[model samples]
Target: MGEPNKIKLGISIGDINGIGCEVALKTFLDNRMLDFCTPIFYASNKTISEQKKRLGLEISFQGIPSAEKAHPGKINVCNVWKENPRIQFGEATEEGGKFAIKSLRAAVNALKKNEIDVLVTAPINKNNIQAEDFKFPGHTDFLAKELGGDSLMFMVSDDLRVGLLTDHVAVKNVANEITTKRVKDKVFTMMNSLKVDFGIRKPKIALLGINPHSGDNGTIGEEDEKIMKPAIASMFDDGHQVYGPYSADSFFGSGNHKNFDAVIAAYHDQGLIPFKTLAFGKGVNFTAGLSKVRTSPDHGTAYEIAGKGMADASSFTEAVFLALKVFKNREEYAELSKNPLKKHQLKKKTKAQ
Candidate 1:
């Protein structure tokens, strides 16, 4: 009743066979989480009960017919799936894949209708989930397809933030996808996300070089100079503080990444390898350039550690916190834009104006 902050959150249960349900339950067990926001889970009640039992936690779940009934201190399960094909830990099945997809679809619909403030998704298995009915390389792509196009995937943490230009693609095809248009769009998204999602007034960005030692100035490869450099120059011309085409090998070592607010990598491994190596269980996977705020943990569904209770809930918790922060930042940015202020002004006015 304290001012009715009324923050409603939508959580998509990832693969039931994985630890998604376990972490989702554990993360909500903290009454402090309810104090910040009301979590509305898109999963079956049976699955939630099973997961709680599996984790040996006596968490209580309440079924809410709609978001309006959600309250603090109690999780509201929407129950997306009717049939509970209880899956064994660490094992993958078509039913589990379908159930996960159903939850995702329900969450997306709620997002599209503006029923939820933000979405915090758990990790899912890509191979098992990709079928004729459900076809997406990952959650980001699926969310993009559902919400529209032109979304960027950025890993977020307090110290280091990295954005991937191309995600969930084979290494051989990554080079072909790194076109000038893609780079420009991704950079624009990254800068906007930092400003609007993370509340950075003037976001500083570092672009990672695709080759070793930044192509050694055409000695190794010309993609960095030919494709990446021009994109950075164009962004500079527009008056954004973006730098680099730095070698992936030495960028982190130089500590230059710490200087910038975010780093843009050329491909999946080029960005994630450094981010995960540094972030480990701390980073949150934030999908930028979307109409709605969405975040997930940086790591995947660890089938190996699935029922062992070894899966750390820290990253998943961070994902929830970051998603809420992004949602709040977006609201703040919108308010500021409607009544433009002089505290911070860009040389080139935003299209939002």
Candidate 2:
């Protein structure tokens, strides 16, 4: 029952005991949000009610059996599970993890069936969300396996966009994971995402080095010169406007990130530390290089502020908006690519041949 041409957004409530429901409810409280998309939350009515009562919120949700029952201008809750798990705010319990996986799996299955146009997920407890059925590092890894694509963890905000070459890996293993093929794949993914998701025709990407001062010209480390520089050179030869192996320490400190359209960091903390530092409450984590659109807030489940009503919903709201924008942009770009002249008027030739 969504409005004509409106996208159907599927939301996966993460870590019931955390601030997932709080931020989600806050983000959807503004009635105007329904104008762009119909949100179908993958959670039970009991869960929503518990969150509302705990947060002292007044927003109401229309309980539905499935995504198809979602109505326009109304927040819909799809009961993925009937069992009402105990809500332990500011605590990570096994029950919380179990319900989080249930919600996420339900939403993901719905997405594969084309029941939702885009997905906006809340935060999850990575450690507790592990079980026999669900065993992955985080959302990106799970989505990569489910959706069958080389997923890139792309953090996006108004000021900067960053993609990770080695995501959710330990620092000791980062260098080994940054192979030539991985670098090329990540950069190519970033390039395509920039074009299709953000509507950038030709994006200039910067690469951050794993070592200090980009290995200080091989005096500090050889990876920057041997691995990173060669990979960048290959990309440039293939007509990509990519540069770097730039020093991570001075890159953000000197504001060199402003020079590029996007950045590719060698590891997670290398990129996220700066991204969160700058756009902590307003960044969106986009899963690039996937067939389906999926995004999440650039933060985790703030257990400490779960029931305190102090969790900021800015990142979650931005994630919703970014997902919608990316979905629309991809659709428009696909149509335009198919019919190059669809939006341009052909000039009449005036020649005496």
Q: Write the per-residue lDDT of candidate 1 for residues 1-353, one digit (tens) a residue.
A: 31246578899988988888877778877877887888899987787877877788877878876666665667889877678777788888877788888888898898898888889998898988888877789999999988885899999888999999899999999888899999999998988888888777788898998888889899998898899999899889899898988888888877889899999999999888888998988999999999888999888878888877777899999998998888888887787787656324542354346
How close is every model to the real structure, measured as TM-score?
Answer: 0.94, 0.96
The TM-score between candidate 2 and the true structure equals 0.96
Candidate 1 minimal-lDDT segment of 10 residues: 342-351
Candidate 2 lDDT over 210-250, as tens digits, reads: 89888999999799889999999998998889999888998
Q: Which pairs of residues have clashing backbones in candidate 1?
A: none
Best by TM-score, which number?
2
In angstroms, how far off is 313's CA in candidate 2? 0.6
lDDT of 2: 0.91
lDDT of each: 0.85, 0.91
Candidate 1 scores a C-alpha RMSD against the true structure in Å of: 3.4
